[model samples]
Target: MTRHHPRPRPLAALLALGLVVAATALVWARAGAGPDRCVERAERAEQRSELVTGTGPEVLVIGDSYSVGAGVQPDQSWPVRLPGRVRVDGFSGSGFSAGASGCGDLSYATRAPRSLRTTTRLVVVEGGLNDTDQPVADLEGGARRLLRLLDGRRVLVVGPPATPDRTWGEVARVDATLQRLAGEYGASYLSMLDADLTYQDDDLHPDPAGHREFGDIVAAQVEAMLTSS
Candidate 1:
């Protein structure tokens, strides 16, 4: 007499398979699945209007983790904290030339078109820190490409802040490049090279207090630029 064990049940196998798939999906999502998953769209609608249209005042802001408020809430981001309605589109680990290592090709230039709107009077592009390791030419070219797409529109290029972990020289180079491009494109440039900003545990992103301080500084700068223009 032969003793044979019952084959594994199809239903049990299917359940186990489903769990595995679900776990994998969760991991993938956390690992920068796509722009929708990584790029945060935040808006502060109740503030005073700056750039107005039929739909009301709106400003488009695009950048990386710093712009996305990496360590804080959506409302805490500098863009959102700025006066008026701000449509902030931020992808972590991205920049003008640098693509997010985990989030596919989500550079400032690549995401610019999607966020640009006719009604918006101002387009604020805040980034460059991620491109610190990239070549100077690459950074310039990337910024130029994005500025070209924003031709004829109001643009404010806010260079990345100096982080404790990053080399100050590289950060300054990126800032200088962005400043030059902003001048060429007739856009306003806000250099953060001298900004004494605090960061989170990672030493890369700003903390809540840092975001607030950054927002205040940027808000003042933006207001002055708009008033002059």
Candidate 2:
């Protein structure tokens, strides 16, 4: 009888390859999944509030370095330009998923409620650029947590702007996730990628002029929403 022996090495190699492919597919799928659902209602409230308020509504801008106007001053940031009392609660070096243990205690979602007690009419949460470097699951969980915290509030989600170093595909994915999250949470989603281009500097953080231009675009969108409402 002929000895029948399977090639263990080839089989092992094929199995490893299959595992790698499957893992990659899973990561891709998770990354592509839409934003967290907890904040959908807040997103909607933002739109409705915009339509009803007419010109300008109270806004709370919360995030990391981006929202803090890293390279710019306080006055140039969008939070400084909104019609009503605009409170800026962004922290430098704080990632969207960052907690007290990671970097700082001021998370965009957590610090927001604590800082602004008087029923802020609108809230803008922007972060995730830092989280992109972490695991996709971590990003999703952090986003969901933030959404949950914003439940029953009005919110508008600003996503990560495009960078020359990052691929357009990555930007699109991030933006898509943001839009989906806004939709699910009932908030309005705005793209800052295009607005970023109008700025003169190529630094990850925009300059004062860049901040001013960004503020204008954001103000216009807020105005439009208020007018429609």
Best by lDDT: 1
For residues 74-118, could you state the per-residue lDDT of candidate 2 as single tens digits? Answer: 555555655555666665545455432133333455665565556
The parts of candidate 1 lying over 4 Å away from their true place are 1-56, 98-102
Per-residue lDDT of candidate 1, residues 74-96 (tens digit): 66667766765677777666778
Candidate 2 colliding pairs, count: 14
Q: Which stretches of candidate 2 lie over 4 Å from their true place?
A: 1-56, 99-106, 196-202
List TM-score per model, in order: 0.74, 0.66
RMSD of 1: 7.9
| C-alpha lDDT score of every prediction, in listed order | 0.74, 0.60
